[model samples]
Target: MSTPTTAPATDAASAETTAQAHGVELTEVAATKVRTLLEQEGRDDLRLRIAVQPGGCSGLIYQLYFDERELDGDAVRDFTGVEVVVDKMSAPYLDGATIDFADTIEKQGFTIDNPNAGSSCACGDSFS
Candidate 1:
């Protein structure tokens, strides 16, 4: 491990860097929520996978899906027992991303707090 010298949580772009352009932060709460969801679905082989794909309402779309397969250039980060794989192509754009789960009265879903996005679409399905 290098070092987590970035500032505490304030804005999303706290650790902006040119070398490791993209940064991601997976909250413990989110990891726990994922573990519970996997258990409920009886998918022991499933893991949360986050990726950035081109062509969306904006310039790019944030893709979050469950994956069981692993390929080359994939960065795997394990939290508790949950695994998150970021593909090589998407890693750069998603370097400083924060994965979180929210269960509120309004909307209950997983949210990706990415600082790389300069702008987001109206639907919130994609960003640039």
Candidate 2:
């Protein structure tokens, strides 16, 4: 007779942890744009990092870029092939935020829809 061995955490559990890791969501359009940008650069070692810094008219500004370094307490989420990371210090301010891409004559770029933002600047680039 043999005893059954307990398995490690399942994919669902890991996914759940990932979902709760950061309340930020990356839209498919944003993910596709990031993947295309990475492909154009001929690199795959970078991640999309979103951060909140002190600046802008509203006193807080958003910083989004491609980063290769991973710091401690960074919350990471993978949107298909693209990875999105948010530092612990910025997590609270970014919770429930959505990242999306737009390519149009009126505007073209990555946009953040943050529910946590009480009021944003006229330029729509900063929040209080």
Candidate closest to the true structure, highest lDDT: 2
Best model per TM-score: 2
Model 1, residue pairs in steric clash: 22-95, 22-96, 23-95, 23-96, 23-97, 24-95, 24-96, 24-97, 25-97
CA lDDT of every candidate: 0.80, 0.92
Model 2 agreement with the true structure over 35-107: per-residue lDDT tens digits? 9999999999999999999999999999999999988778898889898999989999999999999999989
> What lDDT tens digits, residue by residue, belong to model 1 across residues 1-128?
79769756654443323222335677898999988889889889987888988888788998888899876667777777888888879987888789998889976888888888899987788999
lDDT of 1 at 67: 96
RMSD of each: 10.2, 4.3
- Show where candidate 2 strays beyond 4 Å: 1-20
Clashes of 2: 0
Worst 10 residues of 2 by lDDT: 11-20
**lDDT for model 1, on a 0 to 1 scale?**
0.80
